[model samples]
Target chain A: MYKHTTDGLRTLLNIPDNYQIFFLSSATEIWERIIQNCVEHTSFHCVNGSFSKRFYEFSGELGKKAFKEEAAFGKGFYPEKFEIPAETEAICLTQNETSSGVSMPVADINKIREKNKEALLFVDAVSSLPYPEFDFTKIDSTFFSVQKCFGLPAGLGVWILNDRVIEKAKQLEAKKVLTGTYHTISSILSKAKDNQTPETPNVWNIFLLGKVIEDMNKKGIATIRKETEVKADMLYNYIKDSNNFSFGVEDPAHRSKTTIVANTAIPAPEVNKKLEQFDLAVGSGYSSYKEKQIRIANFPAYSVEKTEELVNALKKTIG
Target chain B: MYKHTTDGLRTLLNIPDNYQIFFLSSATEIWERIIQNCVEHTSFHCVNGSFSKRFYEFSGELGKKAFKEEAAFGKGFYPEKFEIPAETEAICLTQNETSSGVSMPVADINKIREKNKEALLFVDAVSSLPYPEFDFTKIDSTFFSVQKCFGLPAGLGVWILNDRVIEKAKQLEAKKVLTGTYHTISSILSKAKDNQTPETPNVWNIFLLGKVIEDMNKKGIATIRKETEVKADMLYNYIKDSNNFSFGVEDPAHRSKTTIVANTAIPAPEVNKKLEQFDLAVGSGYSSYKEKQIRIANFPAYSVEKTEELVNALKKTIG
Candidate 1:
């Protein structure tokens, strides 16, 4: 948690001393804090998946006006297509949509940043940060959870901020700040800087994450990414050749290498139930495609043997 | 997550359907949600420890006028000491102060309820809910986290609300309700009733907690409390006879059986550093007493063997 919250930002993102960062117990807490803190001006939501859509909904509940540019799930929004309103103060995007198995390219984000210099850019990189090529220099604020790619338990969220976002947060704090026992970002930032947490943190998980990050650095992030890509490719190839299965997202370029989302002709719930009987648990589709799709994650820690077992189980269950 | 979010309140707190309830992610979230949703007139905070003090701070930040009945950190507030202000909309109290190892008796809350029927009573039971003696019938809202006596990892918070609190929430939702991705009480409650979560929850920890709760039910809450008391007694007995050790909170009746807060004649940070060598990690003092105090928790699942090992290590370090 220490490395991800502090030095990790310095190394991965060119986080300057002027920028202030805060940690939340979860990425979802980030959205709650954003609504409570930064909801004065209109926020623009460029959504392609469930998580981003949820954020747009959250902004509305806070009585904040929002301009939304949403594509079909698993499709990315081109930067040129985004029409930001004059009142837009923030642009929110999910760098990678884990549930749909798609990611927005860096070029797209750069284009958006070039267009909206005044609007703060916020990215949800929960499932993409450590394994994928993510440069924090492009966004104003980015948030990631420890559980997804960091190989740590789900409890803590690491949020990185640029100087502009920090300025915005300071302005918000001066207003109607809702300081709670565990949800105070200002309190969390003070403790996080000291390698501590405001409330009783998941100390065991934080200890383990430090070890995981150390191990990752030793192994090299490039090597880990390469291995993950190969694992994802192997599964994608199998799905392509299979007569009964098809990829959920139409565009190959938009598909996520970390999570493989597939559509089966059969009902997803039935297939999921059958897969579970074989002791193989696959993610059932969420939202619109709930009954029609299933997601298989090829995270960094998933060994080749386990991947093979899952493939074998899939073959047997589908057959 | 399912049992607690759905049936835990009904089963554990015996909350009738006639008494509406709401679910929040954490106790802190509840405070903010209450301010955003239920603040009307003014709130009264019984400030005796960190949790209650934090609530008073929250009200101040929200720009809501609140009255604080100040008591020392280790003592409970006498409900009859002050007349409830006619403008007071709610009365908040921390059932147990984890930092001070102090718990307020339920009868004290009942006394407040009798005196101020117009003011809704809120309890921060983060450290005391799971104890066998915690009766839920007297308060309007009670919240706790899974990490404390629940023996579950931290991420999710457990909360119970009476009809009055629920009615207040409903009234606010009818007005301008604050929406949250993970911290929204409405989202958690809606999904919880169906054994689901608003967003992706900490599945592994939630699964572990289900198992732990099942084990607790089998063991019985009364038996669990009795065992914890015995464990506290054994550790406190050792502390009482030790030459260099002393209880931080002087009041015997107010001391927490779950968390034994002790102040050593020696500097705390120095003694804590020494204790780390034995792999016995105890909590450090918060705020003003950071240099002189340490907190030892004897919650459920923390074995007697472990406590004995900690005691031996403490003796050796002090000697």
Candidate 2:
């Protein structure tokens, strides 16, 4: 079966050819590949979650300069502050930060693009692609994992690049030191355009992904996104009303439409241990907030019933 | 089903911790990732196959210094006249070149290692692991694909690494730029050691690989290797007596015992196309030699009768 990950992103992002597109096996790989290859130019990272911090660290590793506009986990990126460096070749942003459960608004993306006309825009939509309102047209390269939005197996990353990215890759290919292999933009372009792969491709995952896309198309991304919003609202409402539970992010506007990050009266690890006993798994706080906060994902496959179960579990565990 | 792949090269080579390990979904990914990441280091391509040349091209694209010691296809990498660069930091060698049907001798590898202790050794043993005489002691990093020898459905790569390689990754991590994500050495090391993966791994493939390995252990790698050797000999002897066909690589010592590369008086593509009519699919020559050679694989699963059937088909098509 043919999987249209890149095509899906292209349609979503409306990417142009002037951009430089690349794919790594994971969102983390994207950060690393960019830092290693795009050393000649500066990158602007719109920070919110661990992934954004990873980009910041990646830039430091490459000894390149990057500008960061930080926001709390639930807060969206500040487009006005994402000033493209004079030598900036790329502007990096995450469409939806999974860990923080926050998403950058389309208006914010447009404003950033308006400010940085010469700079190529790259976005990590790993967690945001499934939502109906995600505007792909403003970004040069947008990437996600099939496992997240498509509900397929992980291992394959879905990336879409416009003609500009393709041209950059071609130029790089001509220079002869294109450093990407299995996930190289050139190789992926070559194979994907032809509905083939450079080496033995991931057959099973791609097959399932194709099926997932077909199923989603039939169900409509809009309907799915609406359902996700409803689920998020239900959980958020419960958490907000509960005196014993509080949100990690103070701003309601920054709240995630998919994953809800909440702080409980009880210690996070203790709550996590209790949740595990009930066979429920929720994400723990990473980095600075470790053992302090809990993240609940309301992805497509996660039903209202599951959310109810989690809410009840949280109530019982907290009590 | 824990499948093994060329990714296993990381452990087989016992790469030092100070060197970074990057995984592209396929060995092809390695070529591109290297080009993107290792611009400062020169690469020495020692193996004789399509993959080695591809690596050479990748290095050339980067304007990075690269040298290839071309062995005739189906012949192993020979140490003769294989000069190591004074500043060589990496050597790309295929433990078993599947397309060429050749396996490099360990002695050649020893010579290379002795000559360039500072250079990281990279091997593609996609077709030669867990079999008898497959040693992983000297190299720094090695890789393999699951489909060829691991007896699992394709999609996953089983990569192993030593402490030294992990340390090198730490340095990369310190730099905060890693070339891989899901395929990263550090991620794979932590998860794989526990028989798990960082991303949603190819669970089915892993299960199949584990089963295959268990069966191999039960039967013994030595016994399996011996049987494979016998199988290759049987097919080779049959080809030797046939006037209509000839081996692609002239030297018997360098020819792979797993895959048999044969050249027919007729164009290889025509021969392969004709053979497919009988439900027998053979690999056609890759790249430059597309119509020149046909590769018949003698995996452990192929019995003596199957080998005979293939020989008869060859005779019927060309003789």
Model 1, residue B241: C-alpha shift (Å)? 8.4
List where candidate 1 sits over 4 angstroms from the true fold.
Answer: A1-22, A151-153, A175-185, A232-242, A269-282, A303-319, B4-26, B151-154, B177-182, B226-286, B291-319
> What lDDT would candidate 2 get against the real structure?
0.65
Write down the worst ten-residue block by lDDT for model 1 chain B. B176-185
lDDT of 2 by residue, B110-194 (tens): 7778777776677666776644253445676666666886666566554444455455555655665534444455555676555
Clashing pairs in 1: B101-B256
Candidate 1 structure quality by residue, lDDT tens digits, A1-319: 6555366545534456655666566788787666556557578897778888888877777667888998988677777766888678888888888768877777788788888888888888888777656455667787888888877767667677766765666676776544233455566666766876666555555566667666777777777788888778878887897766798877877777777888878877787787787777777787777778888877877877778888877788784
Give the alpha carbon lDDT tens digit for every residue of A1-319 in model 2.
5536445433434345443333335556566655444434467788888777777766754556777778766577666654556787668888777776677776777788878777778777787666736444566666777677667656666555667555655655566544454445665666765677667766777767666766666676667788888888888887888776688666676676766788767667777788887898777766566677777767788877788888788778764
Tell me how each candidate scores on DockQ against the true complex.
0.36, 0.40
